[model samples]
Each structure stands twice: as structure tokens, then as C-alpha cells.
Target chain A: MITDFTPWQSLGGGALIGLAAVLLMALHGRILGATGILGGVLRFADMDDWRLKAALLVGMAMGPLVLLALTGQTPAVEIPISTLAIVLGGVVVGVGVSYGGGCTSGHGVCGNARFSRRSLVATVTFMVTAFATVYLTRHVMGV
Target chain B: MKLVSALLIAVIFGIGIALSGMMNPAKVLNFFDLAQIGAGTWDPSLAFVMGGALAITIPGYWLVFRRAAPLQAPRFQLPDTKVIDRRLILGSATFGIGWGIAGFCPGGALPALGTGEPEAFLFVAALIGGLLLARALETRGLRSKPAI
Candidate 1:
């Protein structure tokens, strides 16, 4: 049983995300959704976003390097799952986004602001599902 | 110019996710661990992140909405679909399972590449595969729908 509150870091990071979202919408008239952005670009010749999307991806990839250079440290990440689980999970998420139309950024962040009923519903649905999943895995299955 | 600006914004976003600790899968998975839901062990940092993001984006979006169009682009491009059908529910449920299992959603997953995590590479690759396959199916469905 442990609880930690990193108020400044969380708040600062979140504000940056908000700023990026706002800038994306303001400047490009696009949503700051990673899934939609990447997915749209992966569609071969059908995408008009190849160039910009490639640049955005490059920037995202470089973000940590910049952070590491500035802070001289990287955040700790522990993924306690096998490669198989990760692969399966990623594929499942892709299929889910295909069906639901978006994920956290698209629905949770952008869609909510737009006051879209679909986003609201989608957000609630995923949150509940996430809660239930953890409960079942941690409590019931003990896995 | 657009590419450079997009790169800058994405860099900022990626750094934000890293600084916020959202880039860590364990941090997010811990939040989803409902075994501590009622207990004091629950991590609420994600809430602060969500609140902070929404605090600025909400008003910022509205201000832009008031504008006839975007500052640089021709017009605002917003989603319009509103149906709450089975696809939405089932898809979200499926996504939740994967997220709960891995604690890495799309946004959380991508920026980890910046951190050079080996595991992130696998997840991103698999996600891309899923998206490509599903998109192929989606287009096929659309193409065949008219015939049926």
C-alpha cells in the first residue's frame, strides 16, 4: 500500500500536453491523438499526412533524448509482461480503436472538450472496463 | 514551416509525457490496479494529469471554436460521429483489457520510444500491425458494403 503525489511534475507535464493539443488544433486544425495520427499515416498512399506525421513522429521520438540531455536522467519504466502479452495487447488495442474510432487522446482529451456524447460514452466505457480488468486480474485471478 | 512547428509541438508533448511519468507503464498500471481502489494505495497522479490537460485545452478549444477558422489552417476539423452503438462498447472493452494488462494506451505507448525502452518498440510495432490489418478490413468492408 503506497501512495505518491507528484503534483508539480504531473501538473507541468499535463499543461504541456494541453498546450500541444491547443497548438495542434489552433495551427493545424487537427486533433492531438497519437493513434489517429499514426494510423492515418500507415495507410500507404491514401494518407495526405505522411510528411507532417513523419515529422511529428520524429519529434516525439526525440523528445526523450532531449529530456535525458536536459535532466540527465530517464524515467523508470517496468513492464512486467512477456513479449507475447505486449504483442497481443497492442493488436487488441488497435482493433478496439478501429471499432471505437479513437483512444484516450482522441476521446478522453479532445473528444471530451468538443462536448461530444460519443466521446463521453466512450470514455466512461473504457474507464469502467479498465477498472474491472485490474480488479479481475489482481484480485480474482491473482495474476 | 508546418513540419517544423509540428515537430516542436510533438517534442513538447513527448517531453511532457516523460516528465509527467505517464511514459512509465508501471505508473499507469498501478493506477488501474483496483485491488487498492478503496484503500489508500491508489495512485491519483493520473487524475492530476488529466485535470491539468483539460484545464487548458477546454478553454483553449472553445476559444478556437469561436474563431471562424484556425490561426494557420483553413478551418477547424472536429469529429462529428455520435452513435453509441455496439462497436463503441465492444471496442472500448477490448481496449480496456489490453490497457489494464499493459498500462500502455496509444498516447502512453508512443512517447516511450523517446526513452528508448526495448519493450516500447514491441508494443508500437504490434499496435501498427493491428492498425494496418484493421484498416485493411475497414476499407474492404466499406468497399463491399455498397455491393451488398
Candidate 2:
């Protein structure tokens, strides 16, 4: 029934995420959704400017390295899925975020925070689908 | 000034994600496990992260808006679209499946580079490819409704 819980870590991490979102909104008047940030990189013509977004993306790529140097703590990531699965998953994720309008940051954080009805629906839809996919893949298909 | 702040905040965000253990794939996968759905089967710790983030952000937004303009920028950029439609659902559903399969969303995927795993890089590459593909499609007039 029950297993592991890291209330403090989750809460704190979430707090940081919140802080980032709020700070970005507060200072820059923008949302910090990663997909949007990345996607915006390509549509420079329609956008007002791309410097800030590009900076954020660069900072994102380098931030973890900075964190590692500071805390000497390594990120814990394990991917045992097949190459095909990962590739397909990555492609779909790319398309999905593009189609859906945002990913975790956009929909789950800023979008919902703004009380955007579309965001709320999008968040619920994705979360539920993720849960179901996991169930089917893990429980049913045994993949 | 804006440039520095952008990088500073993003770096701070990366630290938070790392500290939060979101950079860990196993931990995230567990969060999505149906076996751990409710009380005890799995971990719901990550949900708290979302809660914690909202606590500050929503109010922060209100506070910031009180000012006529942003600190360094000329004006405020916010999302104003308000239509819920088929595309949103279908797009979200597809994104959800991808997330379930990899246990890594765009947010966490970047920090995943910290792990120094080749797979993470490959995933990022593929993700970029997908984004480019989406851009290509949209440029060809195949957009759903212009996400932003």
C-alpha cells in the first residue's frame, strides 16, 4: 500500500520551482515553461526577442554543472529502456509539448497558477494519461 | 541586468530540481506507478513540489503586476489564450504518454545532463529533433493553434 515519502525534499524542490516561476513572472513578465522556452527559440520571427529565452536555455544547460560543482552531488538518472523506446518517447514528447502548448513547467506550474482553464484541463489530461501509460506498460504489457 | 537575472534564476532552478531529486529517473518513474497510486503503493512526494512552487508563484505574480512595468523589461509578457479544445487534449495526451515512457519531462531532462549519461544526451537530441520537426510542420501551416 504505502512505501517511500520525501515530504521535505519534494516540498522544497517544489518551492524552488515555484520561486523560479514566480520570480520569472515577477521580474521578466514571462512564464518558465521549458518547452515554450525551447520552442520559442525556433520562432524568432514572431517573437519580440529571443535573447532572454536563449539565455535561460543556456543557463539551464549549465546550471546543473554549477550545482554539481557547488554541492558535489550528482544527478541520479537511470534509463534502462530500449533505444527505440527512448527515441520514440523523446520524439513524441517533443511533439506533444509542442501540440499541448506546454509541458510540466508551462501547464503544471505557471498555467495552472494563472487559473487558465485550458492549463488545468491540459495538466489533468497529461497526468492521467501518464499514470495510465505507466500502468499498461508496467502492469499489462510487462514492458 | 536582465541577462544576468535570467541566467541566475535558471541556475537557481536547476539547483532546485537537483536538490529535489527530480533529476533521478527511478524516483520520477515511481511517482507515475499505478501500483503506488494512493496511500502507500508509491511515492507522491513530487506533487508536493508543485504545491510548494504554486505557494510562492501565484502571489508573486500579483505582487509584480502591481507595478506599471517589469524591473528590467519594457512590458510584461503573459499567456492570454483561454480556449479549451480537442487539440489541447490530444496534444496533452500524447505528451503524457511520452512522459510516462521516459519519466523525464523537458524540465527535468535538461538537468539530467548532470548524470553524465549518454542516454540523457541522446534523449535531449531526439527531443530537439522533435521540436524542430514541430517547427517545420508549423511553418508548413500544420499548426494546431500556436502554443505559447
Candidate 3:
């Protein structure tokens, strides 16, 4: 059985997200768009520009680590996928970030909040594709 | 520095994920897989994540927009068009398919991958493929219609 979902936890998460977005805007004068950050890193002209990208990526990686440290709960399941598949997944997401002009964080969070038509379209596209893929993979492919 | 700010934001975002239980991929997968399992209860963690995000963003946007000159750029760059055409529907469908299969969206996937989940990586790969295909099509479309 799946563990119970907690409202407090959800609210806490939302608050953190909102705060992060706000802080990014207030301090950096930028939206918290993950895709843009990654893209900038990949296409950066100056090596110094990569600093921000690295910082952002590192923070993302560290967030859960910190939580795990506090809670001491082990990850529930291990995906039995290969390393190649993992790399391929990253590449695919990178391409999507480029094609959509943003990732879920950019479009789904910042863009959607700002009422950006492009972001809305992109977010919708992302969600729909995700849903379909899940259905096919789990239901039809049974993988 | 911008790097510092980026790191700060990422950490805060991570904290939010931890608070909301989104860090648990199993829970996320269960939400998508609702079969064989009992009628799942609402995971309010998502709501908190959304609410918390909005709480900060709503006022934050107001402040940024109010500024005469944005720190990074000349003016706020907002999208010009709002048409819900074929691109919107098609892209959305594709994205949904991916999400449903993998039980992870890009935003969620990033954090999950950060946790060193192998499956998350695979999902990310497929996501990139879809993205690339979309981009190529978009570029082609742009070329076909110079006015756009």
C-alpha cells in the first residue's frame, strides 16, 4: 500500500517553491526557469557564466539529499534501468528543454504564473506528452 | 553573484520538494499507476507545493514588474501571441504520454535524477528525444513561414 499523503507536507512544498520563485525574482531579477539555466550553461560564451548554472544544478541535486538526511527514510524503490538509459533520458530532456524553449520549471511554474501564452502552450504540451507516454509504457508496453 | 543566487534558489526549491514529499518517486509512480491499488487518497503534498510556490511568486512578480528597469534586461519579455492552435494540442498530448509512462515530469524528474534514481535518468533521455523532435519541427515551420 502507498503511504498516506500529507496536506502539511504539500503546503510546505508549495510554500518553499513560491518562496524560491520570489527570491529568484527579487534577488536575481530572473525567473526560476531550469531549462533556461541549463541552456545558458551549455551555450555560454564566457566560462564565468557557467557559475550560475552550476550553482542551480547543484542546489537541485542537494535539496533532496538534505531532506533524506533529516528524515532518514530510504528511497522506496530502485528502478532497475541501465546507465545508458539514464544518460539517454538526460539527453532527451535536454532536447525537450531546447525545443520547448523551457522545461517544466520555466513553463509550468514561472511561465504559467506570469500568464505567458507560450509557457502555457509549452506546459500543456509537456503534460499531455507525459501522460500519453505513461499510459503506453505502463499499460501497453508493460515495461 | 548570479551563481550564488542560482544556488540559493535551487536549494530552496529542494527544500520545498522535501517538504511536499515529491522527493519520493514511489508515491509519484503510484499516483500515475492507480490500478490494483486502492482508490488513492489525495496527496495534499502537491497542493502545498503549488500553494507555497504561488505564495512567493504572486508578490514577487508584482515587485519585478513594477521596477522601471529590470536588473538583467531592459524590459520584461512577455510572449506576444495567445492562440491555442494545433501545436498546443499536439505537444500537450505528447508530453502527457511521456509523463504517464514514466511517472515523472521534467521538473519532478530533475529532482528525482538528483537523488540518483536510474529510472529517472531513462525518463529524462526519452524526454530529450521528444524535445529535439519538437524543436526540429518548430525550426522547419519557422522556415516555411518567414512572416512568423
Per-residue lDDT tens digits for candidate 2, residues B39-120, read 3668877788788878877887778778888777778877777888888899899899998887778888876775677777
Of 2 and 3, the candidate ranking higher by lDDT: 2
lDDT of 1 by residue, B39-127 (tens): 76777688777788888899999988777887667877777666778877777777788787767888887889877788998888988
Give the TM-score, chain B only, in order for the candidates: 0.87, 0.88, 0.73
Interface RMSD of each: 2.9, 2.2, 4.3
Candidate 3: deviation at residue B124, Å? 4.5
How accurate locally is residue A119 in candidate 2, as Cα lDDT from 0 to 100? Answer: 90
| Number of the candidate with higher DockQ, 1 or 2 | 2
Question: Which pairs of residues collide in candidate 1?
Answer: none
Q: Comparing candidate 1 with candidate 3, which one achieves the higher lDDT?
A: 1
Candidate 2 Cα RMSD after full superposition onto the native fold (Å): 2.5
- For candidate 3, give the lDDT of residue B77: 44
Error of 1 at B38 (Å): 5.3
Q: Which ten residues in a row have the lowest lDDT in candidate 3 chain B?
A: B139-148
| Residue-wise C-alpha lDDT for candidate 3, range B1-148, written one tens digit per residue | 6676678678878767656655555455445554424554433345456656767676778777787765654455444556665544444444444444344555666566667766765665665555555456667875321101
